[model samples]
Target chain A: MQKTALTRRTLLLPAVVILLGLSIFPLLFSLALSFGDWGLGRGIPYEWRGLSNYAALLADGRYRNAAFNTVLYVVVTVSIQYVLGLALAWGLFLRPPGGRIFRVLFIFPMMLAPVAVGYMWRLMFQSRIGAANFFLAALGFEPVRWLSARWFAMSVVMMAEIWQWTPFMFLFLYAALMNVPTSPIDAALVDGASRFQVFRHIVLPMLMPISIAVIMLRAVEAVKILDTVYVITHGGPGNTTESLTMYGYNVGLQYFNLGYAAAIAYTLLLVVVAIAIPVIIFFKKEVSYT
Target chain B: MIRLNSVQRWSLFVALVLWAIIVIFPLYWMVTTTFKLRADIYAGPALIPWVDFVPTLEHWARVVARYQQVTRAMANSAVAGLASAAAATFIGGMAGYGLTRFQYKLGFLRNRDIAFWILSNRVLPPIVLVLPIFIMFRTAGLVDSRAGLAIVYTMFNLPIAAWLMLEYFKQIPIDLDESAKVDGATYMQILTRIALPLARPGIIATFLVCLMFAWNEFIYALILTFSRAQTLPLVVAGQATQHGPQWWDIAVMATITIAPLLLVTILLGNRLIAGLTAGWGQ
Candidate 1:
């Protein structure tokens, strides 16, 4: 027993130390920094300020836009991805010819760097020589100005987001649907239950745990989106699509407002944790096979 | 036989086929545009590359001749990805073993609480960690260094790493350890000899996941390194700013950055799918 305990400490203590060194220490340091004013790039000395940056961000338009855009993105992307991902998984379940190839292609975009993926979308969205416009002209429709307006830019960003992640969500749903029991479905079919009714009652509930899990995972990630926006829009056309992550980046790196940036970062952390806690609980319950 | 109507089956097939084509179109466009000469790209947009003009390798050539950071960035990514992945796997294995094998009573913190805390650290946005780590690393003179950035990557990877390894370790039969202990085997001996061998596939899966995280890490690298330690993603992004958006170069760089990972995932496609499945619902 003593040996077991000794070995346990020997193994776990190092991990605990590493975890603390990496997360807790930095979190505390940043928490402290958030309450103090520091403009390191401008040669300003660190000065203590109590919650001023937090107060200031309440009225900061860009911060509000970032927060709104981030939430909007999470909502749009998660819902669309989930709905479409379920559709595609059902479609793919039919085992179409060249599906083997299609699966390969479907996952291709995700394998690329988000920067590269965003850049590719940006190139395609270009006005002068974009393929989207080219195809539009061929079909006799006028080319939509993709990135000119706020809603249009958000739409394009959302498209890129959906196109990349829907495959992942589809993959998850596919696995879940495959493993779902088939006897009940066959029995319902023999009992003359309509396809939609059988699906509404049987398959849907069976897939509920997986669906919720997919949404929770996708929702958490979608909320912290930065890469595509950074590369494509750069929060352009007057800060229309700046995520809180991007807002934090601008404050810290561009404006060199370290204290305010820390505050922005902390708020983002709280928002993510707050949004994610219930989902995380549900996730634990589902994963334990309850 | 599985039951479905002919129309339903065909429609589903057609739907899958069409979407697959739509998905493949942009990726194919990106790759083919890399081969198109400046004239062809600057001119009409053709769906087929070689039919309009013979594809060229000039852009790929320019990635080496005009832009050289691609190579440096590749090297940087390899260092960080390999180092962090390997380190995290080993360290996480230890933590995982401890968690699975022993009981913990640390005042208010139970084992589940500790696990949740570790995983929740991952939920903290990179921005929260980026600024403070930048300051701390700068003060410690670890900025712009591969080791420094690898530590940060390891931090992010560690949560997943420990969690995954813990799950994998749990799958191994504890009875093996009991028998080993009866034979006077130390915990270290049992872990190294009995447990590690049984958990081999999990280790590889965990390693691959860590490498995926490390290789794709962007925000932290952007804030921490200026130029010397730039990763492939950073360099690929740099193509936009370096000379006012060289599409050809960007295509080439993006191709380089993506090809290796694509190949890795394809080769390990089944394993990756398994790992990703494990990631969901938990």
Candidate 2:
């Protein structure tokens, strides 16, 4: 293969154009659209409504509920996945025979589409004829309505999110765990350290960076997740499962309040960025260290 | 080391087996529900396929013989997936190769900045971007078109594709490029012939990932296409929705929607995870 002379000018322009249209354009346009009174009305007559959409959405009870749900969802789901994933990773790190199969199975849920996952669990969580309630009633306990109430609806959403994503944490944590130089672990074991102690001191510190990054990534994905909630709850039981993204979509697409939705979308962006910036910084630091 | 006694070993084995069952339970439920009658499905979550329960091909038959839109959506998804994979592989691959291999004397601030911008853009939520994209597509008269969806998907797929390919390309020492240059070959020739061949695994990994992203994408498909260019996820998801018809048919279609992905994941799960986490930690 012969490499002909190529100048920087030849390659840079197309990349710029792709990134511009994809990333730059949407970002700027969305920001601009947030400020205008664009909706389902005949064409967007540019009426600069400065902070009205934001103020209105903030005052709206629905947006506040969605915001609260989003924060709660992120904290609970991330915490569960992180803890469960680390436990699973440590279990697998023991490297008993057939460990590889278990590892693959652990990460299996991550591969399916979120919508499929939502449906699969929706069937499981079915109160009347669903498996979960069936088992509950079999044990002589009352079968609770999983999707019929606000708290149970949120619980079901959390359950599905955990089921789907714990595997992601397992995968990343396992990857980082695998890369942890085995000598240190072995040394701790030889020095009469228990597995738990080794994990607390030697392993957790080493895995903290990847764990942080994983939390950041999972949190971002969980925040924007619409397909699961869209399928499972449809933000239902009186807007109990309505995340910020779902709320934004409802205002924009369902209600045709484009400007209000745009503002909502921008606010969601800020929330995500607030989470993202730290992760990005952590990621850059991790990258530089390596 | 608490020396694992036989009892401990046996207990560990039991725990592993139990967890394995839990992990695979959902997948098993999905597949089995496809063959079950509606009554059997609603009848207390039978772990074993019911012996007396009649296994009817009705759901499959209904989906195949009756539903034409699903078939059309499947086709749209395939077209969108393959087109985006090819476009992303070619353009993003070239961009990946250029960013990794090409060095200008002045150092390309523009090039590095473009790469950074692409990464940041990937993090931008599609909901935030969909309206702007919708407006743009409507203005261009490309709304509700397959190509429109493809363009949007291509944009999302490109960043990771480029980043993936860049990492893969960087591993192929510049010696190849230098040697190719010594042979007085064109840069395009080196890329297409040498770098591309050496990076075949990387390309396939990237292709599978991009195709998966395209095939399974929902939000953009939901927003961009109403009836004309909707994807499999949109169709299945829409069908299963509370407002839509034939809830059991959703089980059928969800089965169908997940089958291809299941096959791909089971076959290429390792490569998929590796490709996804390539630069995340290391």
Candidate 3:
């Protein structure tokens, strides 16, 4: 028993120590920093601000806009990704001709670095000499500025995000679809059920658990959307497309407002926790039931 | 699997083809743009390599010429990504084996709680940790060092590694451990010899996933490293200059940045997909 205990400790110790030092320690430090004022760029020493940074965050319009934009981006991108991803996954699940090649090709976007994807999309949407505008002109429509406007810029960023991540959803859902038992569906089909009806009644419920899991995964990651936005828009012609992380980045790194940045970071943390906890609990319950 | 009628089959094919076009176009554009001259790149929709514009190796040649920064960055990324991934996989694999094969109670925390706690670390945005980590790294004088970047990446990748390895280890029969123990093999021996070997594919998948993230990681590389340990993503991002982004140069650099992993994905695409979705399936 003692030997087993010793072995367990030995096995677990490294991971625990690393997480403590790198993950938990930094979070604690950031939490403390959030309540202080440390503008390194301004040559100001650290000073206890006592919630002033949080107060500032609450009243900051740009911060609010960023928060809204982030939520909007997450919702829009994840939703679109889910729909498109499910459709593609269903298509692949059907075993179409050349499906193997299509499956490999589909995952290429997801494999590229988000920054590269951002740059690729940025080039495609460049105002004057862009492929988007060129195509528009060819279609006998006037070239519309893609990046300069608010919604358009947000849409472009979200488009890139969806294009990149839908493959992730497809992979997950397709994998789940493959795992789904076919007997019930076969029985349903023999009972003269329509394909749509059989999918809705039989397959959808079976896919529910994995579906929730995938969506939760994607949604949580979407909250950290920064690299693509940073490369493509840099928070845009205005701060319209700035995400929570981007705002935190600006405050922390670019502006050197460490305390305020920490506050923003903490706020983002709260948002992520809020989004994650319920789904986690629900998943736990689902697992228990199964 | 649903049997598709001819109409359904054709529609699915067309849809897949259309989506495939959307998926492949950006990559196509990136690769094609790499061969185009500066004038051709900015000269609206010079897509077809030879027909639309005369192809040139100028950008690739220039990038090859500037191999000092590019190669160093690539080397940094490779070292950091591989180091962190290897470290995370080993450590996380151990933790995973421990959780699966042992029953533990840390006060109110059980194995499940501990596992969830580790996995919850994934939900923490890098933005929140960046400042504190920056300070920590600066204080330790690890700023702009490959070791520092690797250490951080190891930590961030640990949750996924541990979680995925947990799932993988679970799939391995615990009876193997029991039988090995009865044969007078130590727990360490059982793990190293039996479990690790059995879980080799999972470990490889975990390592690859960790490597992918660490390799392509941008924000931490942006903040922590200045010059000495700047990764490829940082190098690619640095292409944006005072005189507008050097699109041709960026295309070249971006291609180089993404090419290695692109090859990995093509080769191990199915393995990656399976490994990625493995944990999520209860």
Instruction: Quote each prediction's TM-score.
Output: 0.95, 0.93, 0.96
**Clash counts for all predictions:** 0, 5, 0
Q: Candidate 3 falls in which docking quality class?
A: medium
| Residue lDDT tens for model 2, B77-136 | 899999988888767787777777755333554445555555667788888999888888
What TM-score would candidate 2 get against the native? Answer: 0.93
Higher-TM-score candidate of 1 and 2: 1
lDDT of 2 by residue, A1-290 (tens): 12224444555556557778866888898888788888555665767888787788768999899889988998999999999889888777776558777776777777677888888888777777577888888899899888888888888888888988999898889888878887887888899898778889999999988888899989987788788888888999878789888888888788777888888888888878888888777654544210
lDDT of 1 by residue, A119-238 (tens): 777778776556788778889988787877788888878888888888878888977877777799889988888877877898889888788777887887777898888877878777
lDDT of each: 0.80, 0.79, 0.87
In model 1 chain B, the worst 10-residue window by lDDT is B273-282
Error (Å) of candidate 3 at residue A89 is: 1.2
Error of 3 at B175 (Å): 1.0
* lDDT tens readout by residue for model 3, B72-167: 998999999999999999999988988888887878988888888888888899988888899889889999999999999999999999988998
Native contacts conserved, per model:
0.52, 0.46, 0.67
Task: Identify the leading candidate in terms of DockQ.
Answer: 3
True lDDT of residue B281, candidate 1 = 34
lDDT score, residue A10, model 3? Answer: 88
Off by over 4 Å in 3: A41-43, A286-290, B241-243
Backbone-clash count (model 3): 0
lDDT (tens digit, per residue) of candidate 1 on B1-282: 135687877777788878777677767777888999887876767667568868899888878887667888889999999999998888888888777787776789867766677777777788887888898898898899899988888888988888898888887878888899899987778878999998898899999889987887789988999888999888877666455457877878877877887898678776776765664433
lDDT of 1 at A240: 88
